[model samples]
Target: MTDRNLRHPSPSPDATTSIAAEAEGFLLAQEHRSAAHREAQTLCDALPWLTTAQAEDLTRYYVAHRLRLSRQLFEASLARAEELRREYEARYLRLRRDLLRRHGAWASVLLACAAGVSGALSTLAR
Candidate 1:
């Protein structure tokens, strides 16, 4: 008869410890608390038949997926920020133009009044 130990070998303690350590590191590095919790749950739900290596592989897959999502979010936020910057710049230019127009109109009225006063004074002296 074939020996059962040879047919099915359990993972070594060191291997289990290494897998656990790597999983813990991955969880800690996660930025979102809820996403990390979900990943932890996924790991816990892994089948008992899975070997340490398989579990580690699954964990790595989850980490990679999370990283991809984070990159997408970062890109979206950057795009939104750039759009807001452009909008603010456009608004500032419009406000500046409005203020300059009003100031120019006021200055023209004041100059006209001053000229009228000077002409009347000269006519009275002659």
Candidate 2:
């Protein structure tokens, strides 16, 4: 086949302007997304009952549902983020509990040592 046909494969002419316009639209959409995410984070933080997963899912739902993009990838990404957030939260809570336990144990040991030293000094004075 000819080089032109080989390169493009399809007979459609290159739509540079159209591609650029679409790219511009995508950038605008991304900016809107960032703003929306910031708003969602604020709302989520204020409303402690709402999990991050729920906020993200709401964001994705609003974007996909309102924008009407047929792209399945965004929905999939939201679901994945929800799952990852759950796992991360579980690990964080476990780590926090472990750290607190260790801290309390160490504090008790220090207190006991202090008391023992004070008792010995008092006896020496007598």
Candidate 3:
């Protein structure tokens, strides 16, 4: 069976994580409720001849389809965001390694110069 673990698992169940999750859930619920009402209103405006019962049934199906489309779009966006993050992070690591290597070489050169200066000064003093 394929492993189901998240590539970047959520942070440990801390208070901040719990609170953020709750807030996001609340916002999504509110958005869904508002969207459903607005969609039903548009449908009613367009099809004024629909009977109340028929309108209600149609609204339900419309809302279901809208939800499915929303889910697909959200998943696609999330995947793209993850891909971008991975690319950016890899580039950052490569750049950081190059910087450290350059800095190390400069530091070694500076240390050698300093040591030579110290030896010459001591010999002159003697």
Candidate 4:
């Protein structure tokens, strides 16, 4: 018979308690309870041959793996947010510069026109 078909001995009381404690620790550390539950359920579903106790222990490891993935996703999202903020700041600066240049040009034109009008009035008086 294949090794898969052999009946394994049950874990000792000490081992069971250790596993339970580790599993409980993982559950407590998770920020999202629903996510941890979902991960446990998925592990149980995938290993139908496992006893309830064995499944519980395995689920803790699975939950830890899920947490690692979540951390990586959060890091990537934070990087993207920072990149978008910088792009927006640069665009705003460019727009402000363009507006200031236009305002300066208009002010220069108005001043030149005022000077011409004053010169014409002086000549007429003379």
Candidate 5:
């Protein structure tokens, strides 16, 4: 291989997956946009009295509003997901610490019991 090829290498599987995900997201966004436009058109259709320009303007405004709301919802969901991740991780750490402490206490008790048993046996032998 050439030096440039060696340095760059090929895309990893993860990179490919990321690309696929991006494409999928793009397609979904496009579909959502079309759906929003159709909805706006349907609303405009209900009002037959509007001029063509007025209808077009109303549709544009409606689509923009829908897009803004969708963006806000998506961002809020991402924030909530981040919060849940942090909460779960903290709870997991707390539970793990408690489990380790419990196990340590049990081990200490078992060690003391064995020592006591050996001491009694020695005393009896003497």
Candidate 6:
């Protein structure tokens, strides 16, 4: 491999998994946006009697409402994301600690058994 390839850091498996999840979210968002556009067009078509200026005013009002709702949605999504991250981190830490403790106990038992076997062999050699 080239020096550049060796030096370049690869994305973690977890990062790739998260990117796939994020792409799915974006796809869902696009579908929602398309549905909203169709609904707005249907409403405009149904209100044919409204003057152009009136329609413009109505669009403006709805846009403002959409902006407010979007802000609320953004905040909620951010909060949920942070909560999920915290939950995952806690679980990962717990598992890591448990594994370390188990391995340490296993190693200690193996070492004690080996010492006993060696001491017995030494006594026999005498």
lDDT values for all models = 0.80, 0.78, 0.87, 0.84, 0.95, 0.82
Candidate 1 Cα deviation (angstroms), residue 17:
42
> TM-score of predicted model 3?
0.75
Per-residue CA lDDT of candidate 5, range 22-126, in tens? 999899889879989999999999999999999999999999999888889989999999999999999999999999999999999999999999999999999
Measured by lDDT, the strongest candidate is 5
TM-score: the better of candidates 4 and 5: 5
Better of 1 and 6 by lDDT: 6
Per-residue lDDT of 1-126 in model 2, one digit per residue for the tens? 899888877534457677877899799778766766676567667877767788788767765554445245567888999999999999999999999999999999999999999999999999
Work out candidate 5's RMSD over C-alphas. Answer: 2.7
Clashes of 2: 0
Candidate 2 residue spans exceeding 4 A from truth: 1-70
Runs with alpha carbons beyond 4 Å of true place in candidate 3: 1-16, 122-126
The per-residue C-alpha lDDT of model 4 at residue 91 equals 100
User: What order do candidates take by TM-score, descending?
Assistant: 5, 3, 6, 4, 1, 2
* Per-prediction TM-score to the true structure, in the order listed: 0.58, 0.46, 0.75, 0.62, 0.81, 0.65
Candidate 4 residue 108 Cα shift, in angstroms, is 1.2
Instruction: Point to the candidate with the largest TM-score.
Output: 5
Give per-residue CA lDDT, model 3, range 5-116, as digits (tens). Answer: 5564556779678999899978996798679769877987799899998988888888888878878988999999999999999999999999999999999999999999
How well is each residue in 1-126 modelled by candidate 1, as lDDT tens digits?
Answer: 359878888779999999998898677566554575578557757677777787777767776787777778868999999999999999999999999999999999999889999999999999
lDDT (Cα, 0-100) at 6 in candidate 5: 95
The lowest-lDDT stretch of 10 consecutive residues in candidate 2 is 64-73
Candidate 4 residue runs with Cα over 4 Å from true position: 1-33
lDDT of 5 at 116: 100
Give the least accurate 10-residue stretch of model 6, judged by summed lDDT.
32-41
